[model samples]
Structure formats: C-alpha cells, structure tokens
Target chain A: MNDKKWIVLGLILFVGLFSFPFWFNVGKAAPAPEVVLTEQAKAAKECVMPTDFMKTEHMQLLDVWRLKVVRDGVSQFVNADGKEFDMSLSNTCLDCHSNKAEFCDRCHNYASVNPYCWDCHIDNPKGDK
Target chain B: MNKFYMSSLLAIFALALIAWVGAPALPWLFGIVLPYLAVAVFVVGFVRRVMGWSRSAVPFAIPTTGGQQRSLPWIKQAKFDNPSSKTGVFVRMALEILTFRSLFRNTRMKMNEGNRLSYHLEIFLWLGALAFHYAFLVTLLRHMRFFLEPVPGAIQMLEAVDGFFRLEILYDSVQFGLPGVYMSGLVLLAAAAYLFLRRLFIANMRYISLPSDYFPLLLIMGIAFTGILMRYFTKVDIAAIKQLAMGLVTFQPSIPAAISPVFYIHLFFVSVLLAYFPFSKLMHLGGIFLSPTRNMLANTREVRHVNPWNYPVKVHTYEAYENEFREKMVEAGLPVDKMPESAPEEMTEEEKE
Candidate 1:
C-alpha cells in the first residue's frame, strides 16, 4: 500500500509538473491567424449590441411572463412572424439554426474549441432537413 | 504560508512545466487516456461515496426543524420551519434542495451608530450560490452533447434556451461564433471567485476557514480556468474530442489524432477534481442528508422519552414486614393482628408451613 501510494504520488507530481505550461501559455503566445476575437472582447462587443437584442431593461417583463407561464403550466410558443404556435424545446431553437455542422462546426473549428456537449446532446433535430 | 496555498501553487507550477515538456512526447496518453481514467474514477468514486453514506446507520429520526412542532390546539405552530410529519419533512427538504430556502433567509449583523447590533438581509451570498450551482449544472448538461452519438433533444433545447439571445438574431441566416459564449461558465467562475474571496477577506470567515475548504475551491477554479482556455485560447478538435468521449462512453476507447495538449491539461485537472471529490469537503453534497439541522425534528420536548435502561428489582412484601413486627407492635401498645403470646407460636407455624 505504501509503495502504491508513493508511485501514485510520484505520477501525479510528474503529471502536474509537465502540464502547467500548456495551461499558462494559452492566449499568451503569438496570436493564431485563425483567432477572430478574444472571449473578453467578444462579450464586450455583445454588451454594446442593440438594446432590443440585449433585453437589459425588459428583463423584468420577460421574467414576469416566464413566471406566469411556468406557474400556470402553460406552454408559450410563437412562429417566426409572432403568430401563436406550438413547439417543443428543440424545434423552438433549431428552427432558425438549421445546418449544425456548417454554423457550429465552422466557428468551433476555427476557434480550436472542444465541446463535449455533442457527445450526449442532439445537434440536429429530427424531421428537420 | 498555509498548506493549501503552498500546495496549490506548487501543483500549478508543476502542471505548467509538465504541459510544456510533455506536449510532443506523450500527447495521446495525456489527451485521451487520462480523461478516460478520470471519468471512470469520478463515476466509481461518486457512487461509492453515496453508497457508503446510505449504508451508515442513522438509528433515530432526527429531522432538524426551525419552527414549532404540531401539538395542542392552543399551541401556535410554525409549519414550514418545524414540520411534524413525513410529508412536511419531504416538503421542507424539497424547498431546501431546489431553492435553497434556508440560505435565502440568511442574515448578517452590523454595528450601528452606538455599536448597537442591526440585522440586515444577506441575499447576495444566496443569489451567488444559486447562480453558481445552476450554471455548473447547465454547463454539465450542455456537455452531454459530446459523449452521446445522438444527443438528447432536451439537452439541445437547454443549449438553445441558454443561448436564445444570441441565436434569435439570425432567424433566416446560419450564424454561429463560439455559440452562446457559454455564459454559464462565466457566471460559475464569478460566483466561485466571489465565494473564495469572501472567505479570504472576511475576518470571521478567514478565522474558521480550513485547508479542506480552500483546496476544493482551488481545484474547481482550476477546472474552470482550463475549460475556458480550451474554448477560447488554445483550441482543440471538437469532432475528435466527441469521438474520443463517445468511445469512452461505449467502452471501446480510441484516441483521435490532432487533439491539443492543453485539452489534456484541462481534462487532467477535471479528473483530479473528480477523484478528490469523494474524499474532500465536497461530500457535503451527500452530508446534507445526515445534517442534524436539516434532518431532526423539534419534538423531543413534547414527547415522553423513556431511557432504555430501566430494570426490575426484587422487593420484600408488606405482609412479611407486618408479621415480623407483630410482637414489637403489641409490646408498644400498637394494634396487632394476633396476641404477643399467640403471635410467636403462629409465626413458628407459618415458618414451618
């Protein structure tokens, strides 16, 4: 048991010592040609977008609507033209972003991002061409 | 000066070195093999800890109640705080776990003009904690897309709902850039940082804070930092990562080419976190069930508590006492069942019988 402990400790120490540079070097070295914008800058840019999209002032209204709908066990959905419509969670979002690979993969690929989400989550909605 | 700070800094330095040196030589082992091992350890350790908790004997129904228990008709009762029945306990536990009801009622004391104590609502901590937990949960749920061949619609829906503000803009056009910016990750990081800082800065909190408390916070922060790095800075192959994750889930493991070394470093920290979770203060996730404050009801005062240690004893009968004292009672002019002269003979006869 003692020997095993020492071995595991040694291995952890070895791994830890070797893995630091990879973490620290991120975003510090030469900027990759594919790099579009830093995460901070991206967030900042989004913060400056139009108020309608940002919804900062209208958050209370949305919150009230959400609380009422959820409390009453009512499902609220609308079509693209704001017409009354019935839709599930997936269809509601996927209706707009149709091509998952083209849209999601393109940016993530350029960004060199590894999203484990696709492992379990369905990227493409069924019955959507 | 503390062991936690010393050890964490040392570990961080070591990992930085390893990441630099081991990049080219053992990318596959670091990137692919280590993550698989971590996930396995996480699942097994989590289950074992939960099982161990379940197996431990409670020996008593000790639900912690903060309100009045149900008693007489005249007695005013606090139903939610002090629940007397099983249903009430269930409701209380549900509220506690789902909404952190107790934390929402937290109070902080401050000294006023004359050093008089004043109580104020401390809702920020509660809100921060709530935000952190929900964000962590959502982020975990969103990651489900990587492990399964066909991701669940529910998870996709969650991602959409989370990124609704971003996705709704391009109704007809296919627009995507680092989808959603993973706002939950940022929120979780901020909350965790705030909690850590609060513990460090507040004199009372700092006095009571232990190395165990700080270590978990550091580990979690490390995981978050690495994750952010992988997403925005040193990009790894998502498709390859998905394949690797799927392979691990399915039990046929394979390391895809072109996976980044930084990804492995992130995975390593996450794995370390998982392995440490069961042994650390993080067990509070399970410890909430055993908490005296949350589990014990305030009914001990009203109920009769018989100590399980009462025993029976042999005793002399009153008739025997009267017979022995009859002669003495006659001599002293007290009433006797038999005459003194007859009593002695009668006693002898009784003895013989």
Candidate 2:
C-alpha cells in the first residue's frame, strides 16, 4: 500500500479516539448516584409532586417557584392534590430534604451539573428562617 | 422536497419511531445491542474504507497549487500554497484543515453584462461550514461527560464556556429547571439548517445536489432537534440517561425505567448516523487526509516521480538504427559510423564487426 505508515498512523488515531470511552472507563464501573432523603422527607410520605416528577422536573418546578415568588410575589404553591406549601426552596424543599450535599450535590456531581442555586441560596439555612 | 431528502427525512423518522415504539419491549436492542453494532460497523467500516483508498496507488504528485510554485530563487514563492517541501506541505495541510484556507479563497465566476468575466468571493459557505464543524466537535466533546466516570475538568470547562450566555429566563415557558442553553448545540443546528437552505435555495447548488448530499444534513438536523427537545421541552431524567451512558461505556448496560422515549429516538438517530458514516460522504473525515490533490507536495518540476505501474517494453536504440542504415547512408553519400561488408573502397572507413 502507498503511504503505509501514514495510513496506519491515521487508523490508530481513529480507533484510539473512538474507543476512548471504553478504555477510559475500563474496570471503573461508577454506579449511579443515590440521593439520600431525610427522615422528614420519608415521614412526609410524598413531595410537593410525585417522586418521578420530582426526579425529572424538579429544576423547572423550582425555577417556576423562584419566578413566581420574585416576579409575581406569589409564595404559595398548590400541588395537584390540593395541598398548599410555601414556594421557597430553602424554606419548603430544604425544610424536608435538609442536607444539600447528600440530597442535591450527589446527583448534580454525578451528572456534572453546576446549578447556580448555591451561588445565592445557602445549602443549609440556620434556625431563624 | 426532492425525493432524496424526503426519503432521508422519512428514514430518520422511521428510525426514531422504531426506537420510541420498540424501546420498552426491547430495551436491550435499542440501549445495548444496536449501539454496539453501530460502533462496530463505524470502526470496522471506516478502517476498511481507508485501507481500500490506500490500495489505490496515486501515480503522480497532483497537489492543487493555488499560488506561485518553487522556481528561481529570485522569484517569490508561495511556500504554503504551492509547497515544494514536506514541512511546507504540512503547514498547507494544517491551514487547510484547521482554518479552511482553500474555502476562504473560494470564488464563483460570473459572466458580466458586457461579455466580460468576474469572480465574487463566497465567504458565507466557508463561515457556515466552519461554524457547523466546530460546533459539532464541541458538542461531541461535551458528551464525554456522560461516558467518562469522574468527568474531566476540560469537558466541564467547555460546558461552562458553551453555556456562558444563560437563557434561563427564555426557558420559563417550557418546562423549568433546565440547564442554560449551550451555544454549541444551537450553532450546530443553525449552521446545518443554513447549509440545507443554501442547497435548497441556490440554483446551482440545487442542480448539483443529490440525495446523498441531503441525507446527512436532514439526519443531522433530526439528531439536533431531538437532542434540543430532550434537553428543554420534553425533559428526560438526565441522571438516568447519564447512568445508562456510563453503563454502556463500562459494559454493564441496563436501562432505567420511565426514561423518556425522546432519549431513545435521539440514540437511534445517532446509531443510524454512526452506522451510515463510512458508507456516506462523512468518510470525508478520512478521505481528506488521503486526498492526493490536497495532501501531496507540489514538487513535480523539481523532483522526478516514477510511475509505479510502468513495465519494460522492447525498444530499438540509436546504435541499432545507425548500424542498420549504415550501408544505405554510404550509398546515398551521407555520413556513416561504420562501413558495410560490401562497400566502396573510398567510402569504407572500417569493416562491420
């Protein structure tokens, strides 16, 4: 073959690049992150939304809550089951799922997501509020 | 639309539908079996295609020189454009690949009103192409976060840069809590769409365009659309998606329940694209490196290039011709190197050996 060395070099590059994920993760089967729910969360029996909805749509719901609170000044959220709760993350959501590292950061770190919620809202609010 | 584009569009839809419809019942097939198969086909087929190209010998140095070639030392030479040396050729190839130097220089010839000719520089094609390719590359690299355990800092940094202009406010109408929109994905989709429109609206381009040309474009658009939809509109359990991605990479494939069918559709389009890569124009990825016209050194004048396929042929030398025609030359009173066996005494200089 013409330019045998160059062809071989290119093939090596192609194979190496495409097969990267395999060798990079070889023997390193990092399991999916498990978010730890607090005792308060467990006792409550359910979140504002269902577990499935919360798992997938929590970010959007939280965003809406923020918008509603800040923009429209509406603080109360009425869930589908006609139960009213405060539309605040630190007050309502964290009131139950308290440990941000255990509950929020685990999945966020696993998914490599850096949600800016921590930039403003404290992970663990103190006793007063 | 042309039948070719329609067929390609229909094909993508069919594949997406198959994954969406078949995923619940055959998660193993969509999530595991097909992905592996697609990768296998892509790798093996790509190698085979490259090998086939290698086997076909390029008998000449046919680099398309775009500037003054190497000649007299006093004459200015365009070293990179009309490269006569290996290093010059390397620089030329690098510039051609990285910055698309040739496409930047692309001009379309136009017949003037007065029977004259003119050339207009076509820069948008180059811009669109550059945008399309770079965005695609960034998007592909960003996806490494999913496959790699302990996702690399580089990818995370890239994601940050790509999503620097956070449009969280715009996403409120759609389901909330979505990550800021990454520019790479949007740019890729927009660029691909622009290229598609260029093919459709431009008269010359439309005339030259074939089904093969439109298939990849439509397929890519479908992939991008599904990807964007999954990220923002029909949000999937990303953590679950990441888990599946990690599992696939680590050879421990398992599908989490209740994951959106949109994910499956996206995966299916990608799988089809991968499987179709080598067989389509996408092989330009490899073909560009081996292209004789682009990759060769423009040194045909300075250096001799022997044709490898040349074979020995019987030939009559000048000596043999002179010897045969010696007697006739002497009789015709012409100069002769040698005397014939029976010749005139005055004409005879030497006996025939």
Candidate 3:
C-alpha cells in the first residue's frame, strides 16, 4: 500500500525483458518439414549419406561439399557410411531436391535459417522437377 | 584496489582459461547449456532481488528534494529538482538514468592557495562515466547480431552508424581501413581503467572502496578485454559462432566443432558476468528505478501522505480521566468534567470551554 509499487513494477519489467527470448518462442514451434526429394533422388533410392545423418548435418555437409568443389577441386565425396557422390552442392544435391521451397526452405524456415547458398550458386534446375 | 584488483582480475582470466580448456572436453556444456543456465539464473535472480526490495515498506514520502517543494500556488515549485507530480518524477529519473545527471553535476573540494576551500566540477570523472556507460550499451546492442537470425534491420542500421567513422583505405581494391573498429570498446576499456585507477591513486577513494566495489569493475573489464581480444586480435570464426549462437536462439543447441579457443574464453567471461550480475552491484541498473528518492513525488506538504502500516492506539479521554480520579480531582483546585457527589456544585458547573 506504500509507494513501493514502482519496485514491484520495475522488477516485473526486468524479469520480462530478460525472459523475453524464453517466452517469445513459446507455442511457436514450426513443425518439421516434410522433405520430398525429386524423381532423381527417388530413382537412385540411395543418398550420399543416411537420411538421419543428412537431416542434422546437411548444412555442414553442404559447406564442406562447397569447399571441396570450389577450393580443393575435389568432386568426389566419401561419406562416413562409405557412400560416394559428387561434392557439388548445386548439381549433386539440389538436382534431386530441385523444389527448393519444399525441400530446403521446409526445415530452414522452421528453424529460421536463411542460407545464402543461392546468392552465388544459383538454384538453376537441370530441368523441371 | 591493489592486491584485490590484481587477484580478482587474475581470477577472471583464470576462469576464462579454464573454460577454454574445459570447452573442448565438454563443448555442449560450455557452448550451449552454460549460456542458457547463466541467463536463466540472471533473470530469476534479478527478479528475486528486486521483488525482495519491493516487499519492504516505505513509510515516508522522503524524496531527496534539491529544489523548492510545492507550497502556496504563488511560490513556483521546482518541478525537475523537487517534483510534486508523477510526470516530474519520471523526468528526474530519466535525466538521472540517461545522462547520469547527478554525476554530471559532481564537484570536488580543494583547499585554495589562500587557505580557503574551493569547489570545482569533477568533469573528467563524469565524462569517463558517461563514455563508459554509453559505449557499453552500444557494444551490447551491437552483439545482438550474433544471436538474432536475418539480423533485424534496425540492428543493421545501428551497426552501420556505430561503424560510420571507420576511415576506409583502399587495400587491393577492397576498402578496408580497420573494418568497423568500434571506438566504444576502446573507450570503455580506457574509462574502466581510469575509474579503477582513480580508486587506487586517490587516498580517499582507496580508503572508501571495498573489494565488492572493485570486483565488479575488474570483472566487467575482464569481460570487455576477452571480448575485444576475440573480436580483433585472435579472430574467431564468425560463422561457427553464429551457428552456436543461433542454436541457443532457436532452442536447438549443438556445439560447433573447431570453434576458436579464444571464442570459448570470451563466452566464458560473458557467462561469468551474467551469473555474477544479479548478486552484484550490477543490480543497481534496476535498483535505480525503484529508488524512492528518485521515483517518489515530492509532495509531502501538499498531500497528507498516510503511513500504510500506521497502527491505532487507545486514547485517554477527559471523561475516563475524571472517572478514574474523581476523589483526587475533588480534593484539589483542578477542574473536572464530571461532578462527584462530594464536590461543590459551583465548581462542578465550570464551563471550561
């Protein structure tokens, strides 16, 4: 009842501002993307890496792939699972998952990642998916 | 300030180094969980501390009045200095918080050549303080880049403006004259060093300063130093940092492999800072707002400010006094409200109104 109201209000403000990141994300979990690979990826019926591995490590894998193709002049990749594929991100990976919005943006948008690979390595298709 | 500062300073660096070495062995713990836990502790502890203060009762409207209070309407009240209204209180608090107005008006007393005391504005301390606080704020806002994805436009604009003074020199057709050299970091470092030294160099300040006062300053400096080192000298990979930072942002934390040891050291410093914040004088950031002297309206004369906790006490009325001492009252010349049977009627009818 005294004039200590500001203290409580200020405390609330402090707590609110600090805990913003924790609550700003509450009930905002964008569902995982349903990855639909193109006919090329489906026809091969096999991927450079296992589905589980690709699910988590695709970004780094693509990063390493880009490094190998662009800098080291290495076109072949040998996954930990003993699978060999071209180290080209645009042609090798994107060729099968041509529908960028459906395949890449699915998880990326859910996770709020805007990868800049399309800035240089254009999303040009080998043909229509 | 002498050995305590050195020991605390060394302790912070030792912690940073420990975190650096421990990070490789426990990457997720250092890179992800620690930051989250530190932030959580900071938020909860800050709230608890402030709320604890709030539960205490303030019985008086004792705003530290620097100017005239609102008396007669003809007497012009000093709204900013001795505010009688809520709006005036806000303005005073704003000036105090935004500009460190009291500090700006700081004075130092010195004995003149003629043996007379003289007061002068201690402007350097104020300037250093102003520079340090502002620079720290800018640096904090600038670091929002690593945590936020797609970096908000406002932050980008702020970053550009902060780095606007960078003198661009053509190097191999790429303009790079110290890529965004934030003077804020250097200014903050200098100001902190000056403030820290002031306590040591000046006898009065050294006598007054406790280890508590010096520790937070040294700890903050440690945080700033490690941060600057990571940013400028031993450059950490920005992308890997972004991965780690963004992981925390999205609540999907994964430790990035091969992140720089310097980055871990910097992160450890920051984590320690966060954890230490609520328990330390850093809570002054929030306490300033809650200060009754700064926040309360100086209107004691105009309004009857009641004490909420004031208790009621029994009163001894004249009737009770006469009833309790009727015989004694009749024995003396003292008048009583009621007449006793043995008392004189003339004296009993006394209209003492």
Per-residue accuracy of model 2 over B40-149 as CA lDDT, tens digit each = 99999999999988878777768898999999999999999999888998898899888888889999999999989999999999999999999999999999988998
Structure candidate 2, residue pairs in collision: A59-B177, A60-B176, A60-B177
lDDT of 2 at B15: 78
Ranking by TM-score: 2, 3, 1
True contacts kept of each: 0.00, 0.74, 0.18
Q: Which residue pairs in model 3 clash with each other?
A: none
Candidate achieving higher TM-score, 1 or 3 = 3
Identify the leading candidate in terms of lDDT.
2
Where's the lowest-lDDT run of ten residues in candidate 2 chain B?
B168-177
Least well predicted 10-residue stretch by lDDT in candidate 3 chain A: A24-33
Native contacts recovered by model 1: 0.00
TM (B chain), model 1: 0.77
Q: Give the number of the best model, judged by DockQ.
A: 2
TM-score of chain A of each: 0.32, 0.94, 0.75
In order, the TM-score of chain B in each prediction is 0.77, 0.88, 0.87
